[model samples]
Target: MSKAAVETISGESLSRIVGAVVGLAGFATAVLAGMTTTNPGSVTLGRALICLVAGVLVGRLLGWGGEIAVKEYLERYRKDHPEPEPPAALVRLKQKRDRHEQIVEEMKKSA
Candidate 1:
């Protein structure tokens, strides 16, 4: 991925990651819940599979929304706190240019 894409956290990657995490959590939860019951068989497995699928779908949606919200918040934050103008290096270069001009003018006057 490009630098900008990596830095901004694309919705696709975020959604997938969130979906996988939520699906795993749901699966684990379902399995644990089933363990408490007297019959931990096909029904438990079915429930776990359903939970995993549902969690992934829901989590993906949530993650996409979260990515958009974060992007918007970052945009607003960047707008509010703008970068400084004439960076330090540029300011130094301008100062050096002014000094060189002054020296050349002084040399011309002396000649």
Candidate 2:
């Protein structure tokens, strides 16, 4: 298949990208907020790590769910609608093939 026809962002990849972005954002925010507190280094670090993990999980789940919902809706829509006709080129190709077959059969009968 052509590169353009290939799926660029699948459900899994989208989930991973969203998870990484959210995880980084949450980690950065937690660290910056923790910096202003009187909490010990270990506690601040712990909170930041927790936020990172939570953010990643939540973001990934949301992304995956959203992808599934969109695909389901599209599938339902497709089922409810009629498929389009074949392209003009394809129709022409089939007609040419039929003509070729007919000529071959006629030549065979004459021989």
Candidate 3:
């Protein structure tokens, strides 16, 4: 619910999208390379499938790398803004605790 949590979730989602795109691109590149470099006699459906799978795997790896980069960025941001604590459920809990304490003190004074 907090901005920090939102940012973290958004970053992760963005990384996944980037990864999928990269994988598709790698697949295309692999197909193209296979078509251009291999002999006509060597070309086969099985070989093409293998190339495609390999490309996708490479793309996924790149995507994971992207995710790591985003995580690093977030870590740096957290380090820089260490003061104003991230808005979270804990903040609300603390607020409630403080109000309860105040009420208890008032009741004691009245007694």
Point out the worst 10-residue segment of candidate 1 by lDDT.
1-10
Measured by TM-score, the strongest candidate is 1
Q: At residue 96, what lDDT does model 3 achieve?
A: 99
How well is each residue in 66-98 modelled by candidate 3, as lDDT tens digits? Answer: 666767777788888786765899899999999
For each candidate, give its TM-score against the true structure: 0.66, 0.60, 0.43
lDDT of 1 by residue, 14-94 (tens): 767887899889999998899789765898999999999999999888777776776777788888999878889999999
Which regions of candidate 3 are displaced past 4 Å?
1-19, 30-44, 82-111
Worst 10 residues of 2 by lDDT: 1-10
Cα RMSD of predicted structure 3: 8.9
For each candidate, the alpha-carbon lDDT, in order, equals 0.81, 0.81, 0.64
- Clash totals for all candidate models: 0, 0, 0
lDDT, candidate 3, residue 7? 28
Worst 10 residues of 3 by lDDT: 1-10
